[model samples]
Target: MDIVTANQLKTKGISVIESKLADKKEIIISVRGKEKYVVMAIEQYNYLRECELDAALNETRADYQNNKFITESVEDHIKRITK
Candidate 1:
């Protein structure tokens, strides 16, 4: 990962990130010498989001296989979650 200071980002703007991203998948934004944020391309972000959904789907499948799921009405589901 490449680190960019907050000052550099402010002075140089998104171009600084765009240039670094040419060779890197992600860039870290540092504030006061400490890492505070990350910047990445939209494609990479979407890929990660898909990976998260896939993991959730796998977990749900496993739960179903183990008979760990419940059947309930919509109102009951809402009430259970809200509680």
Candidate 2:
């Protein structure tokens, strides 16, 4: 991963990020010498979000297949979960 200091980012702005990201997928932003943030292209962020949703969908399917869900009225579900 490429590393950019807070000072560098402060002075250089998005151009620095754009240049660094030209050939890289992501870069780390360090603040006070500690890794603090990550910068990535929007496509990468969206892809990750889609992957997260897909994982959740798969987990929900597995739970259903294992008979781990409940069927109840809306009021009953609300009461049951609230308790």
Candidate 3:
């Protein structure tokens, strides 16, 4: 990850960041020595989103296969419904 100060980013302008992003570069924008934001290509962001969805689906499938979902007892259910 490339690091750039917020002031440096302000001085460099969007063209510089866009050019780097177009080449699939990821930039970390720092504010006062702390990383505050990230810039990446749209394709990279979409790829990450898809990967997250796949992981969630895989976890859900695994949980279903293992019968890992929770069940409540009738007494607890009655208390919830009555309340």
Taking the tens digit of each residue's C-alpha lDDT, what string does model 2 give over 1-83?
A: 99999999999999999999999999999999999999999999999999999999999999999999999999999999899
Instruction: Give the TM-score of each candidate.
Output: 0.89, 0.92, 0.74
- Residue 71, model 1, lDDT: 97
The residue pairs in collision within model 1 are none
Task: For candidate 3, write residues 1-83 as lDDT tens digits.
Answer: 77778888788888767766765558888999999999988788999999999999999999999999767999988998899
The candidates, ranked best first by lDDT, are 1, 2, 3
Off by over 4 Å in 3: 22-24, 70-83
**Per-residue error (Å), model 2, residue 33:** 0.6
Ranking by TM-score: 2, 1, 3
Instruction: Find the 10 residues in a row with the least total lDDT in model 3.
Output: 16-25
Each model's backbone clash number: 0, 0, 0
Best by TM-score: 2
lDDT of 1: 0.97
RMSD of 3: 4.2
